[model samples]
Target: MLSIILLAVALSIDACIVAFSYSLTLNKNLIKNAFIFSFSSAFFQAFMPIVGFFIMYYFGLKFIELAKKIDHFIVFFIFLFLGIKIIKDAFKNETIQIEKNLSFKIVFSLSVATSLDALAAGVLIFSSKLDILDCIFIIFVITFVLCFMSFCIAKSIKLNIKLLQIISAIIIILIGFKILIEHTIKHI
Candidate 1:
């Protein structure tokens, strides 16, 4: 039971981190939009595991094993692209422009990228005799709370516009690099 809670916390940390990054980039409706993004992030974080669990449950674990090989690569590219784009926007002539393009697709992309670990973990946990529904609920709540808290913390601070952009960009890029290294080492 304790281990399951720990697992939920671990998986939800991704949502927290990304929500913090999103908070840094918010120019208007900071609190409103942050919660919106955070809720969606939580939803995806919760949903990915079910998708993974069901896939393995009905189809087989072998497909998941096959997909696992390229999972990190996909996540790395997504975060790397987002990080680079944020950094490039920061360096543009305008110094930093926060576009209010908080579309559902963008939120979905971030959630998917962040929840890759959750998906894999879900498959592993579900393959055992554990209560998959319990794990799913724990994951959802943890992700929701952490994401909301992280965004609030970031939103409270009045960072310099350019500095916020740079920091957010670097944090995202570093996370991507961290994912790449962690997965590569696990593979080796």
Candidate 2:
């Protein structure tokens, strides 16, 4: 249960960052933009994990017994790689420039891009004790809430994008280490 919440929070950070970015540029139709971005983000964030879960579930089923031996390693490496990637991308200092005219296509595209990590994260769910549906609900709710709050928050204050990314990366990396250590201790 704690793992699910942590993973959801970590995964949703990307969407929140994007929402915060867009919120700065948007000057009109704030409600519509927020809804579109939030819904698109939440839907993909929730759906991609199920897709990833099924992908591993179906393809890796034959190797389940073998995989159980090294699933922790798989989860660790994936989370580590993602964490490093996020940190790396954060340092690039890429400017987010979007038109004031928001479209479903634009928001949808960004949502898909931001949620890609969640898809990769889905594989880690198999290692957890919680049900997939429970994970999905948690992810959807957290992501939606965070993104909506991000837009509201962005309107009044400036947040350090790089700082947020770095913190999120550390959380993910620590979670990876936690899982790795837990499994290693059990195996010993």
Candidate 3:
């Protein structure tokens, strides 16, 4: 249970970071939109794992191992790309304008993109022999809590949003490196 909780937190970090980024711009409708954002993030975070698990579980054990190899690489690159994009935005000459577009499609896209790592993480949970339902439940709860917390905390801070975004980007990049290094070491 503890491990599952930890894993859930790990998978939710990206969602939290993304939430923090958006929170910086959200001066109005904060409460209503926070719930909406949290729900969207939690829904995808929980749903993706189930999908990844089912896809890998049916594919056979050999494929699971193969997928693990590919998963780490994919996870690393995706986070690296996202982090780079955030950093690039931070360095832009124009003031960073937060697009407060809370449209379903845009929110859904953000949720899906941020939850990509969680999809790969489903395989890890499967390989660890954890109960899928319990993991999903824990993931949903943790992600929702953390993401909302990040949103609230971000709004409270007076620091420059661009600096916070850069810090968040560094964290994302570090996570990507950590995944790559840890998995690569395991293979060795």
Best by TM-score: 1
Alpha carbon lDDT at 124, candidate 3: 74
Point out the worst 10-residue segment of candidate 1 by lDDT.
94-103
Runs off by more than 4 Å, candidate 2:
61-101, 157-188
Model 3: how far residue 100 lies from native, Å: 2.6
What would the per-residue lDDT of candidate 3 be over residues 9-110, giving only the tens digit for each residue? 988987897788656654567777788999899999999888778877888566656755766677677678767876886777687844454557646756
lDDT of each: 0.81, 0.72, 0.78
Candidate 3: where is the Cα deviation over 4 Å?
A: 1-7, 21-29, 102-135
TM-score of each: 0.92, 0.62, 0.70
- Deviation of model 2 at 125, angstroms: 1.3
Between which residue pairs do clashes occur in model 2?
A: none
Candidate 2 residue 81 C-alpha distance from true site, Å: 23
Model 1 C-alpha lDDT versus the unseen true structure:
0.81
In the range 20-93, model 1's lDDT, one tens digit per residue, is 88678777876677778777877877778888888888888787887778888998998888888888888887
**Candidate 1 collision pairs:** none
Q: Which one is best on lDDT? A: 1
| Error at 164, model 3, angstroms | 2.1
